[model samples]
Target: MDKNDYLKAVDRLNLWAKAYYTDDSPIASDDEYDKLYNAVVQFEKENPDLKLSYSPTNRIGGEVLDEFKKISHIAKMWSMEDIFSDSELVAWILRGDKTDCEFFAEPKFDGASLNLLYENGNLISAATRGDGSVGEDVTNNAKVISSVPLQIDYKDKIEIRGEVVISKDDFELINSERSKNSEPPLANPRNAAAGSLRQLDNSIVKQRKLKFYPWGVGENSLKFNKHSQIMDFVRSLGFLRDDFCKVIKGIDELKIAYKELLSARELKPILMDGMVIRVNDLSKANQLGYTVKFPKFMVAYKFPATEKTAKLIDILLQVGRTGVVTPVGLLDGVLIDGAFVKNVTLHNFDEIDRLNLMKNDFVTVIRSGDVIPKITGVFKDRRDGTQSEIIRPKICPECGNELLDEGVFIKCQNLTCKARVVSSIIYFASKKCMNIDGLGDAIVELLYQKNIIKDIADIYRLDELSFIGLEGFKTKKISNLLLAIDNSKTPNLDKFITSLGIEHIGEVAAKKIAKNYGDKWLELTIEELLSLDGFGEAMALSYLEFMRVNLEKIKELLEFITPKIQNLELKTNIFSGKTVVITGTLSRSRDEFKAQLESYGATISNSVSKKTDFVLYGNEAGSKLEKANKLGVRTIDESEYESLK
Candidate 1:
């Protein structure tokens, strides 16, 4: 390839890497990206003096760092060269000397790399691999990760490198919460882990339940002859090491390990896109040295990209609870990642404009470690002038209300639109909200369709006679549902605020707001809300505007219901003015424990800080316990906590 071709390849690969690593939205398949990257590498090799500094080959990660403080690495972190097929793996193995050399094979974690520093057995710093030589400091966020040890056995300073990842289960749970709040789902586990760890508030990071697995060391006082020995030492220090790491003898064993990992990728707790094969002997690794961006002794063998092409059958508009309308693409039935892909989300109208997507276009759909399938790109080659342009709807499909365009989103402004009302009612009765049992989506829909319930307030007015003739509604069930509705009349202040579904106000924000203002939050002005910590102008304004329009509705609703607000001033007990952090799996739920503590005048904190007076621990208590110990804060077990009560 010529210089111009190299330049173009460089630009293209950078774009793909940025999308893949930073945005979590990959435009190209892994195979295509690898091929382009290899071409760029070849061109750079041919014209060594003309290599560009900003080439994708020389970068550790493509994320833009603005939130966290930047810290320079004591030793440069390196990425591994990726090989796709068996033949390429064999060729890479042959490139190194095979005399008495063994390979250490482990799953290549598909997550963000974090470098941690320990001084005198205490964790001092945690950082991301920003550009190999510098990283963003995320020590506070890392402290909450259960698998990351807050204190180790080593008394000297050491630097351990690990991958911070969210498990598939936790990723799904987080996405489920995001969906409940009408927020866009994270693209994959890797992106979720990165985004969670980079949060400015460590409390948010704690809720993400991110785990860390140590794979290598950057700087250590202790010496080891083999990579496996290093991993063993790290594991002994209470760090999680890859359970699948194996010391294989030759290329055949390496290939076997690769095949096994690739076949069991979906079965693993964490996401692994491939396997990493490294020279086992530490001296041999040093001898092999390093490339500008990758270690010469190791190669990451990526599994084949999982992508399939399916024709776009139709486009459907999904109206969220907040009235934001999203375009979904209906695709011909195709299997991806062992699941049937019938539909993929187009995200928004801006995405439609960018893709120029249309009906009957053959588009590439990818599952990519997420349950929700996404349309990555359109196949222009298959288009034979038969495809029809997707028409943008001028009105809400459910209520016929005129649509309002708000930058990237088009929304239905009708507050009482059927779709919005149904969704809101369901949310208000959800398990996290009023906890009105038996009032599920089907029941809410049935009531709405029958014109028996028009809004959230209507739910409390339903009579048993209204459900007498409804399908599946027996007399006993109707009585039970009415009782549930009555029970929901008195809810916690946080739950009451959360059930309101104010834009950008989720349960966590609601709790924070309630904790500060108690039952008087409605009395606060927008400027006062903006002055509160963590409240931005947009969020504060949205809250004020929502209250302004819904005050009368709220007053009417209050006539039939009451919220139990916590009065911190009334609790003048022994635990008063104490900040308490809870850790581990307690006998009772965390919420129950929190309520019990708050009733005794204790402030609940999610993370351990210097202000923490006590850390209540239970079985399998993690880093927070160690952090409490390190800070010389008192820690009580569940038994001791109960004794106090």
Candidate 2:
């Protein structure tokens, strides 16, 4: 490649690296990515003078973070030196004195490590482990973490350590959206959570529903210095801690706990990469402490590699939300980390070039515990010279249209890919959008498949004639669905904006845009939109450009629909600004009630508590009701809710 191509490749590599590290979701596959990466590496090696400063291979995750306040640690938080195999771990243990030792064993959670400070029973600060000694303080954002209490029960000044992790359910949900939006899928929950926490916009962080759990302490926090006592004390302070922790008396008991922990790892919520062993006794811990960075009293016991070799059969293209084409690796069947692996996300075109991977190539694959097996490395020696170069589709697989090269991604130019259509339909009928009932993904797909709907606007044109011969469709069901669709014709300004699926504009962002633009949603200039809170230059320009191109089509559709303005007069109503929680089976589905409440401009809390305005109950309410009663929140039965509605 020429110098210009080399420069371009380096720039792209850096962008992908940032997306991989900061975004947690990578746009390219390991093979494709590594190929580009290796090319840069090789180029830098061959012509050292031509190497650029922004090259990805030279960077670490130590950039100065602005989102959080910088702080100096009382003690250096060194990364645990890893031993990948059992023999290596045993050797390390034997390399040091082992007599009179009691290891306090716990799981090494795969999440973002955080350091928390508490003084006079209240949380003073929380920071990420940026380097060893200094970190970005994220105390304000940490306050939103329900697992990390703002005030602990303990009175003494204390510093605790923990990891922030996004739950599997949330991770899947986020990744699904990311895939739809043509963004790279997050590799795992750990990266997903870390990325979410580091987002400059707190609202995005809020939407992520990030959680934290205490794992270690920075300085003296309790009367006891032993690992077991410290854990118990930390738990008592209303912080979530690893549940599998055990005080093992000796190596035999330690081995037992390790086995038990490994077994229990299957049932744990957070991902466990390995087990951490610390001295149980305070005196023993202090005596064994300080070997450069890691405490001699503690060592991480990593699990054996569950990796195996697999053959690259072929590459498949998949379309995402924003029409980005993704490459998926079809591999020879292999068992990895207890799961069968047939396919793995290849990421993007850049990845294919980087790995120098092609069809029929042998690759080393590893399932990093219970997740998908990824091609970590390629075995060039195994190739028999019959390997075929996999071609990335120039058109979208889902919707056959010439793809648009959007710098980082090869996106579908088709405006109506099935995935995009489904997402758009869902968004249009969503609670914060048009608030249509009985309209979800299944119904949307069916409507599209049966040729009853072509777009969101087409939903209004559906009748019983078009609905005939569909699965499980009854007269009443059809009538109700039609009524819901018809009712959704009247959309609110905020809802209309949200339904547009404008880039970076969700419900909250939509509301801000609508309010700022007033009656001139389309008339508002890009500069005007960019001035709105949380609106960036890129997002504003993207929205404006999309609107400018699609405005006429939208305007024509508007003739068949009317803007549904809620009684903004109800702003002064009793429940207007108050947050409410509803538990138990409602007269309608929980989603329905949430929709109804939100329509009237009320905030919905996921959990019941004292601050909750009211807990709307139905038949057979569970612990939430009991908790609400204890907290003295107003309890309203279905009858009361019906009367209010």
Candidate 3:
């Protein structure tokens, strides 16, 4: 057959595939489609260069890889904030002015998040959403998944981010097959789908029968007025979109939709954690922007938590890193949300007082997913005379010092408390703080017990000889840990502040304080801290007092620790104060060029429009190039762009 015949076969097969997988309307019988597909595959094998990206042959598994490579995302993939109660959802909807807002609601599938990048109408890379900004390349594994489109007509450069899920029936079938093979059943569908995607062999992925559902897009060149338009765009490109996805008008609509979706949650083929509510207006959503952890314009209304009743046996006191004496309840072993619960934190005395919990008295423990269990109710009627009221401790359990009752919390205020010092050291070495990789809770405790590290500052004074005398501290392990400690000397300023574990200040508050003050973060005033996001009077007061008492110690640590400098300055350049659109692959990744242009005070946009000042082009540029030409937007190649820079 000639090129025309091969093209016809490929188009027919792709069309039939889209109809079957996406629209649920198969046009041709499986046998009939297979005959044509096999023929096309044979022709493509004979004429490899003539093969098209959209061909049906790509769906059959064949590719193999030794290991997955890391790739950076064009933009950050922020996770949405979750609200479980109707009141919380209502507050989220009403938090901002929303008179003109329309919301997009879709099932929040519980599966591995995947990011698929396409350029010039072809799938270029597929990755697991690893830490939002970077992911492992899974292009070969993705090709075997039937729902993931290999090509689309509208693509310039776009990233389709979605959930890679295993349907209920498919998951059960897979587990049953494993049982017959005398293999252990997979833990759950979510884990099965996640593990399958990372398998080095594509044949294994093909057997998993995974499905892809596009929840959202990352960076894309196509212009969208509303989020619905983006859904439409992906649907047109042959992705299997959620059937329940709809646009909700207001709070009332959102409330109704949430209830309806919750009722039908189990009916879904794929497991859903909840439903996402996003502002439909693209412009309004962008203006709302994001917080350190979540997008302000969007929220997830999580389904009702898996609540199971458990009995609280006793209450115990523990000292935290900040010397706060917290109450923890000892619960009778109970299972909630697949995990066993033995103990739950009481946070403060106020929580215990609120619940009126007593030792040996039955109390209801509420747990959601991985969130720690809490005492929500006390079975007063079932309580026997043997039950004893929980007593608030008058002295610190670790140091035997008189406790200072500061409203909700009780503190040790003893700088040398063994428990507090050890916990503080652990916090300082944690991933979110200094990120000292090799220093963990066990190592910190061992070091503290040996009198090697008594305080955060003491960590800097430790040497190889300190661990040389200890058992299980191998030479290489000690060397790596020492290197990690040395590396943490230059942690981000926000993280360093968070490592201090102030009573009221957390990561978000610490970030706001650092970003606002930058290099002068140490000089932050209580008045200035009060103005930052999420900072209240109590937090500001706690921050000020902590600094006031430990400023000298912090200064001493600063001699050894240098926080990362936060400086973002726009340079004066020809592209300054201009709107620029970048399309097509360049000599380097688009991210590098975009960062360079942004640093030069230029606004980098996705789509070409009348407002666009310059459209940067490279080899294999697609619709963006054409649109720029017709719109009379100035086009510049690599050399011209270099000249401009």
Candidate 4:
């Protein structure tokens, strides 16, 4: 056979392999594909120079590696903004002017993103999407994937981005085998795929049977007019493509496609959490550009959350770090979104009343974007006369104090509630607060159980000798814990305030309050607090009540810790007391610029409004720049910003 005949045979077999492995729809029998593949391999061996880049012989597995390296991507991989509902999706489409535009829609695979680099048509490197800019090299594991082409049809250097996923059947089979061997079963298909790809042994990855589906081009020498054209080109290069990817003309077609995909989601062999819609025209997408986090040209439409029904066995009252008494519904074990859930948050007493929840009642539990389960609704039809009505608690379950009703929420008025103390200590040592290492929830619970520690102050007083014989606590571990506790004694004011676990006072709010009041924040009156921006009656009242009740405790905590306050008053520059809005992409990261501006006492506002005193514009300024111009805010470029500083 001639070179042309060999090329045709290779393409035919490649398509057949893709159809059977990726699309799960075989066009030819295994024997036929194998016959053509062998013919192409023989031709390639006889005429090595005439061998095509995507010859069927290149599908053989690759060598193992001692360790995975790290590689930088040619282009940054930006995540898409998520839209939850149809209305939000419509709003996003209209924002990009759907009348003159086209869209390419495909399933958003629930798996790890992998970037493949090909040079001279040979696979050179493969990396995991580790933060977009840099990634871990997984070339050996990537080569083991049958769907991942070892050599592509393209000649020049090109980068392709795709997802690595495990089919449900393969996942279950692997788990069953592991169970037979008395090994721990993998969690889910996504986890299994990631774990398999990261294995040091390439043979283990090959055994897992992971698949790849190319969705986008990262960096390419060839230019395409539209995204659909790029997809076609990628498919021609022998890479597995998403079979359902389609081009739509307008919003109506987009809506129809979304509905179709949603309906077919259950039939898909791999997990798909949502559908990704991108602007079809590449030039238009470039013009639309991106924000600090996501591109404006595309949006992900998430499917409705998975839910399961479980019988409410009992209701447990739990105290949070803020002393709020929350109702937790204990349920019979049920699977939802691949995880077994036996409890769901009722949120408050109002939610229990809203659902009219009763013991033994069947409730619908939902696991949306959060790990915690929530009871969305009750199945009234399934409830029998044996079910008992839910009763509101009259006292705190931990401290035996009478609960105080506060409209939608009920609080344990006692600040010394044991559960509240435990939760507060845990929060204080959390990464967002004092960041005490080796202090986890279980350890905090154990300390509380043994009366070794009582409060945040007690954490600082712990001696290494106290943990001498504690389970899992060796001398080195105890020394590390004591060192962490000692290091946590000097927290910044914002972190200290956040560690207090005040209601409605998170890290951001705490930072704002601390910046405005400085060292005198604890001494601020309710009226003074109400005068501050973002402070309302409820928040002001909460602050006043907490300060008044816990003044002595606060003083005692102050004795044990040093709260470092940022002196905003020291900034007497021109930017001081000004509200600034930043637009477009600057040379440095947006976060760095924001921090610099804040250091000079300038407040950063997300949007351009009449109150904005200055607008710092950079390259590719978009709607915010137009808004700033219309509002007549003083605009400056990067050079002007440097001059001002």
Winner by lDDT: 3
Q: Give per-residue CA lDDT, model 1, range 1-645, as digits (tens).
A: 999999889878766754554344789999999899888888888899988754655432234333578998888888677677878777787786754579888888888999999887778899999878899998878776756766566888889998998878878788789889999777677878888878876767878888888889998767789998988888877666666989999777887888888889778878887888889998899999985447889888877768898999999898888899999999887755434568798889889889889899999887754447888899988899889989878899989989998878889988888888899999899887899998999899999999899988888888977876787676767888899999999988878998998988765557667878887878878777876655788888889988988899898889889998864333456566588899975655777887667656567788998989999986446589989999999999877776676
Candidate 1 segments exceeding 4 Å error = 1-305, 337-339, 368-370, 474-480, 567-645
Root-mean-square deviation of each candidate, in angstroms? 23.4, 26.7, 15.3, 9.6
* lDDT-based ranking: 3, 4, 1, 2
Candidates' C-alpha lDDT: 0.81, 0.71, 0.82, 0.82
- Cand. 1 Cα-lDDT: 0.81
Best-fitting candidate, measured by TM-score?
4
Tens-place lDDT per residue, model 3, 1-645, is: 789999999888888988888789999999999899889988998999999977878777867665688989998888677777778777776777765689999998888999999998899999998877889999999998999988888648889999999987888788779989999777667778899999987988999999999988888876779998999878888899778999989778888998898888667788887889999998999888886556889988877765667778877899988888989999886754333567888888898888878888777777654456787788899977988878888899898999898788788998778888888888888876788887899889888888888789988887888887797777777888889889989887877888888877765466667777888777778789878645689898988888888899899899899988665344778898788899865655776787678657676787889999999986446689999999999999877988888
Q: Ten-residue segment with the worst summed lDDT in candidate 3? A: 333-342
User: Model 4 clash pairs?
Assistant: none
Residue 25 local lDDT, model 3: 90
lDDT of residue 625 for candidate 2: 85
Q: List the residue pairs that clash in candidate 3.
A: none
Against the true structure, what is each candidate's TM-score?
Answer: 0.45, 0.43, 0.53, 0.63
Q: Per-residue lDDT for 71-125 in model 2, tens only?
A: 8777677666555545655665675565456667778877898888887776778
